[model samples]
Target: MKIAELLRSAALVTAVAMIPATTATFAQVDGRAGPEFAKLFATYQRIKASYVEPVEDEKLIRGAIDGMLAALDPHSAYLDGSDLQRLETMIDGNYSGLGLSVVMEDGAVKVISPFRGSPADEVGIKAGDYITHLDGELIYGGDLDEAVQRMRGIAGTSIRLTIFRPGRDEPFDVSVTRGVIELEPVTFEVQAGNIGVITVNEFSRDVGQDVFRAWQGIQREAAGRVNGLVLDLRSNPGGSLDEAVELSDLFLSDGAIVSQRGRARGESLLYEAESVYRGEIADDIPMIVLIDAGSASASEIVAGALQDHRRAVVMGERSFGKGSVQSLLPLGRDAALKLTTARYYTPSGKSVQEGGIKPDIAVPQLSDPDWEKRRKYQLRESDLRNKLINEAGLKDEELVEDNLADPRFKLTADELKEQGVEDFQLHYALETLRRTTPSAVALRR
Candidate 1:
C-alpha cells in the first residue's frame, strides 16, 4: 500500500488499542550507540552459543523486539505476520469470533469492553472482567494474542470462558457461541417525544458520514422536528482518529476540535471545525453524550471536543483517558512498530492522558446489579501500567469523585428492571434531554 493509505489504515481500530499512524524513513543512528549495540549483539551471540536449547535467530530477534517495545508502554508493540493480519481483519470489520476488545494486564487478559450486541455482550461478558481460562484450560500468564486466537473460531463454535470478576466471590464460566462479528459502527433510533438516540459503537471507516446519515434517517423517521438527541458512547472502545474528528465536526460548526503535540517535527497537528462537515447536522437540538470507563482514545477525542465547545451535555462516568496517538512505522515488508508518537488535547487544551474527560453530570448506571461492586474495580487509563502522565497533573479529589454517596442514585437493578428501565444512564440522559428546553441547552455554554 502507498505510504499515505498505510498511515490512514493505522487509525482504523482502537478497541484493541490501535490508532492513526504515519510512516517515516528511519534517521541515521547516533555514533554513541555503538557500545549498546555491541552489548546487544554480544547477548544474542551468547544466547545462541550457550543456551541449553537451540534457539532460532528469528525467535530471539522477535523476543528482543517485543521486550524493547514492552518497556516503552502498554500500547506500543511489534506487529508482523498474524498480528498484521489481525489488524487488517479488524479494519475490514468482519470476523468470526466472540467480539471483544481486550488488553493484557499483569499477565492476565482483561476485557476492555465487548462490542455492542456481540456474542460476548449477548452472553453478559462485561468490561473489567478477567479471563482466567478458555475451555477449562488455564490461560493466565499466557500470550494475549494466543488467547484471542483461541477465542475466535468458526461461527457455530462455542468457547467456555472462565471469568474472574473483581467483586465476585469465585470465578465463573460462561459459554459464548462465536458468530460472524459484523460491526455496525453507528445505529440510530427515534424515541418518544421525537428524540433521536444515536449510538456510535466505534469510530470505524466513514463513521462521520454514517452519523450524518443517521441524523437524516432520524429526521425522516420522526416525521417532525427532532426535540433532542442522545449520542451514546458507553463502552465504546474507540476507533479511527479521522472518524473521531469527522464525528466531532458533525456537531461543531466552528472552533478548534483537537490538537496533538510531540517532540518530533511534523508530529504536532491542529485540527479545526469546518474541515469535514460544513455545519452542525443538528445545530439547534439539545444533545447529551454518554461515556464510561470503556470509552477511550478516539472516543475521548469526540467527547472532549463537544464538551469543550459546550455543544453537548456530557453525562455518565469519566472516560478511559487515552489521549496519546500511535503511528504504525513500517520496519520491513511484514513488520511494523505501533509506537506512541504524540499526545492529543481537547480544544480547551486539556490533555486526557491520565485524567479522562469528566462528565458534566456524574450519572452512575444504577440499573446495573453490580454497579457498586464494579465501580470499586473500574479501570481507566490511570489504572494501566506505565501510562503517560497528564502533564497538568491530576488532583486526588478530581479522580476520587465516585466515593461520595448520592441519595438520588439509590435505585437497585431489580427496582429499575421492574420499572422497565434497562439502562439507567441512557434513561437519565433521555429524560434530561426530553425535559430540557432549547434555551437550557444554550445556557450550558
Candidate 2:
C-alpha cells in the first residue's frame, strides 16, 4: 500500500514535539505487493486461527498499524480517543495538568522539560529524569498514555511523582499540584539600558503577531528607540511550523527562511523572508537569540533562519536537533496517524536532524545548582531511538561538544545566587548586549 493513503487525517496538528497531518486517498494495491505481503497475510491468518485465546480484530489491527509506524521513527504514532483529545488540547493552548513535555524511552516515561513557571518547573523537576512510578505505584514498563493520563487531573489536585534522576544514587518522590496550563506564547519586558527581552514560551497560533506586538510594546515602554533585543527560546519545545516561518519573516526582509524535502512528490517546499510578513520590524536593533538543549523544532527553525541571514546572534548551548517534518494523516473520523514525512533545512542547507543548531556563543546555565550534573545527562533528538541520521554523516561523538573550561564563565551556582542573578544564561546575554554594539558582534561562518 502507498504510505500516504494509509495515513490520512481531517485536521493537521503540527508542533515541534508533535508534527501532524496530510489528506490523501489510499491508492490501489499494484504489482508493488511482493512476496512480503503474502507472508504477512499468512502470518495474520495463522495468528487469528491458532492463538491461545480469542483475540479481537481491533487489537490485532491496531497492533499491526503501530508496528508499521514504529519502525519509521520516534515521532510517528497512532492517535485515537484520548490521544486525539490531547493533540486538540495542545492546539487550543490550554489544559489542566502538571505542565510537562515527556516521551517514552524503552518503556520508561522520561521528562523532556517542564514548562517555565509551571508546577513541575516550580517543584525543581529537571529534564532527563526518569519517572518510574506515579503515586507510589510502580509504573515502569507501562503504557505511556496511561502514565500521562495519571499525571493529568483537575486543577488543584495533587499527583505524587517518583523520579529517578540519572546522576543521583537513589530515586525520590515529589508532590505536584496540577493547575490550568494557560500558555502565554509570547511575553516581553524592557530591561535595563532599554534592552527588550521577549521570551517565547511556545509557538502557538498568532505567535508572530504576538512577537511583533511585543516589540512595539517594548519600544513604547522605552519612550525611545530600544538599545538592543534578546529573544529567549531556552527550554522552548517547538510548535506550529507556520508560526516559525512567520517569526523568521519578521526579522529577515529577504532570502530563504527554511526548506522542507520529503521522499514523495509535492512534499518539497521553500519558505522565504517577506512571504509571511512584509519587512523587518526591528531592522536596526542589535538582536540576540538564546537557545539551549531544550530548544527544538520550530525554535530551531526561527534560530536557524536568523543566524543564516546574520540578522541576529544566536547564543547559549546547542539546540535540541529535530529537523524532520511530520504530517498528521487521518485514518478515519476518530483516528489519525502522526507520520514523519519530510526533513527541513536551514537557508545554508544544513539539516538539524542529529546535529542541532550550534550557537554563535556557547553560554551555559550556571544559576541552577545541578546544571553540571544535568548537562552530563542531557537528552536531545540524536539520543532518541530510531532517529533520522544527518545526511552529512556526522558521528555521535562528533555531535557532542567536549566540556572545556572558560575563564569568562567562571561563576558557580552559589556565587550567581549570591549576586542575585536568578538566570545565568539570560543575565549573560543581557550583559553581552550592554557591553557590545551590534556592529562589534560578528557572525560565525
Candidate 3:
C-alpha cells in the first residue's frame, strides 16, 4: 500500500484514505509468496476440519491479521469497528471518556498518560498504572478496545477503576466521573519573568495553528514584552506528522526539519522549515522545549527538529525514543493497517529510534513525589516488546543516563510545594530563561 500523509505515535491513531484494490495485487503477491500462501491455506483448512471447536471464519481471519501485525512491531495493528470509531474521536479532538491514552501490555490495559486537566489527571490517575478492573468488572486479559469502550460513556457518568500501580503494596480503587474531554492540544500562559509557557498536550490536528495563536495570546497578555518561550511537551504521546513539522517550523526559519527513509517506494520524504508556516513566528525569542520519558514519535520530531536547528534548548529526561513513523493504510471501508512505514531522523542525521532525542540539559521533575519510583516503571519505545531496533547500535550507557545531582534540585516534593513550586521542570526553564540573556538563551552558533 502507498504510505499516507498521516503519522502518529503509539498512543494516538490516524484517519486513512481508502485505496481501491487492484486485481493485479493478488497476482503479484501470489507470484512472490505462492508457497507461503499454500501453507497458510493448508493450515486454515486443517484447522477448519480437525479443530475440537468449530471457530467462526471471522475470528480465524481476524486472528491471523492480528498475528501478522503483532510480529512486526508494537505500533502497527489492525483497525476496524470501534478502533475506527476511536480514530474519528481522536481526530475530532473531543470525546466523552476518562481522557486516557492506554495500551495493551501482556493482556493488561496500561495507562500511557492522562490528558492534562482531564478527569483522570484531576483525580491523580498516573502513568505506569495498570487498570485491572473497570466498574468492579475484571478486565484483565480482556480486549483493549473493549476495555476502552467500557471506560467511555455519556458525560456525567462515573466508572470505578481498580488500579495496580507498580511499587504500591496493593491494587487501589479509584472512582472517576467521565466528562466531555475536549482536548485542548495547546494551552498557553504567561509565567513570571515574561516567559510564555505553551503546553502541547498532544500533536492533534491544527496544533501548529493552535500554538501560533497561543503565542499571539501570550504576547498580548504580556503586553508585547515576552522575554522567553517554553514549549512544554511533557507526556505528549504525539499525533499528526504535518503538525509536528508545522510546529517546528514556527521556531525555525530555514533548514531541513526531518526526513524519513524506508525500504518501500515513495516511503522516503524530507521536510524543511518555511515549507509549512512560511517564517518563524517567534524567531528572536529564546525558546526551551521540555520533554520526558512520555514524549515519543511526533514529539520527538518537533524536539529533534528544534534541537538540530539550535532553535530551542531541549530540557528534561531522555525521551521515549520512538523514531519510527506509522502510516494508516486502508484495508477496506471499515478497516485499515496502522503499519510502521518509515524511520525518521533529525536534521543532523540522528535516528531517535532507541536513543531518543537527548536533552541539551537534563532536568528531572523533582516536584513529583513518586518521580524516582515511577521512573523505574516508566515505559518507553525501547521497553516495548518487538520494537524496531536502532540502527546506530545504541550503547547501554547511552540509553540510560543518570539524573544530574544538582544541589539546587535537592528539594523534596513537599519542600517544593511549600515554596509554591508545583512543577520543577517548568520552574527551572522559566528561571533559566530569566537568568540568561536573549542571546545566551538562543545559543546561536
Candidate 4:
C-alpha cells in the first residue's frame, strides 16, 4: 500500500472532557496531553514560513494528520467524508464498486476474494488474481489505495480491469458495470451422497442473519431429516469479530468462544454459547469446519471458538494466525485509521499470533503438477517478499503449495500417494464426527 493511500484514512484521538463537545461520538480515547490545537496551528505556520518553495499546506497537513493518527494503531484511521460514509456502508456488506477484496501482496493489488453476485465475482475473478490495471491505466507499482479508488464509482457505472491468471499469456481485460454488492455470507447445498456443504466465505453485519437463513434452508431441503454439516470456511479471510462470536454462538454452549487482552484489560472474556436460539441441529448433529491459511482473522475466531467448545470438528491445516484486534478510528475528511489495539483469544485462552490454531485433523492441500521436487528451491518468507517487490507483477504459476504451514502436514496431491491425505484432514474430520456422534449418543442414553 502506498503511504499516501493509507494516509487517506487517517484519524485523530478524542479531545479532553474540557474540549467543546462536538458530535458527542468521539471514541473514548485516553487523553493525558492537553490540546495540540495551538501546536498544530504553529506547525502549519512553520511549514508555510520555512519551506524553500511554497509546498501545498493542505496536502502536507493531511499527511501530518495521517502520521499523527497512524502512530496510534493500524486500525484507527481518518476517513475522507466520502470514504467515511463508504466505510459505514461497508459494515452492511454492500458497496457501489467493483466487489473485490484486495491486498498488496508483492507491490501490487492482489485480489484475495471476490464477493459472489458482485461485478468482480461475476467477471470470473478468483482468489489470488492480481489486478494490474483499471481502465487501461497500469496501477501496478503505485499506491494500492489509489488504484482501488480509481476502480470504484457509482453503481451501474462501467469499469475496466486487467488481470493476470495462472497458465495465461499476457494480462487480460474485462469491462464490468459496478453494481450494489449485496454480500451473501452463507450458502448451503447437499452435495452428492448426502453431504451437506455450507460455504461461509466472509463475515459482515448480515452474517448472523444470513447464516440462520442458510441453516433453515438446509433443514428444509433435508425435509425433517438432516445429515452432518460441512461448514466450509476455506479462503475466508474473515470480517467482523462480533459476527464471528455470534456465528459461533449458533452451535456452542458452556464453553468460551474468544477472548481479548490489552494493557489495562487483563481479565479473560469467556464467551459461552448461550442457548439463545435453539435449533434442530444442536449438539447431537455431526459437524465439520474446513479451514486453510486463507481462513484468517475473524474466520479463525469462528473456527477456533467452535473447535475449542467441541461444537465442530475442524479440518485443514492451521488457520492464518491473525488474532489481533483492530479498531477503526475515524479521522477527519472521511479517512480512518485502522489501529491494532489488542490480541484476541479463543474461548480456551489461546492466542493464534505466531502459532495459528491447530486443527484436530490437518489436511494439506495438494494440487496436481508437483513443482517442489522439480525446482528443489527452498524459499524463505523473505525470499518470497523480495520476489514480489522486485517483480512488481502478479505471477500465478509461481504460487507453490499454500499448505506448507499446516498443523498436521503440508504436502501436495501427488505426495499423498506415499505421504498422502487424499480425503484431506476434512474427510478425516467427517468420518471422526460420524463415528463419534453415534457412539456418544449411545453413551448418553
TM-score of each: 0.95, 0.92, 0.93, 0.69
C-alpha lDDT values of all predictions: 0.85, 0.83, 0.83, 0.62
The regions of model 2 sitting more than 4 angstroms off are: 1-25, 28-32, 442-445
> Which residue pairs collide, candidate 3?
none
Error of 4 at 431 (Å): 8.2
Flag regions of model 4 displaced more than 4 Å: 1-47, 50-53, 68-76, 104-107, 122-124, 141-146, 153-160, 164-180, 265-268, 275-280, 329-337, 364-437, 440-445
Write the residue-wise lDDT of candidate 4 on 354-393 in tens digits: 4556776656545423222322332222233211121223
Between candidates 1 and 2, name the one with more favorable TM-score: 1
The weakest ten consecutive residues by lDDT in model 3 span 1-10
Question: Model 1: which residue pairs collide?
Answer: none
**Per-residue CA lDDT of candidate 2, range 247-283, in tens?**
9999888999999988767678898989988878878
Q: Order the candidates by TM-score, highest first — what do you get?
A: 1, 3, 2, 4
Q: Rank the candidates by lDDT, best first.
A: 1, 3, 2, 4
| Lowest lDDT block of 10, candidate 2 | 8-17
lDDT string, candidate 1, 1-445, tens digits = 3334445575545522233333423345687999998999999999999999999999999999988888877788887777776766666679999999887899999998898899999999999999999999999899988998999999999999999998889999999999999988899999989989999988777888999999999999988589899999988878777889889999988999999887777778899999997877888888999999888889999999999999999999999888888777766566778888889999999999888999999999999888789888888878777777788888756777766778988889999999999999999988888789858963357
Q: Give the TM-score of candidate 1.
A: 0.95
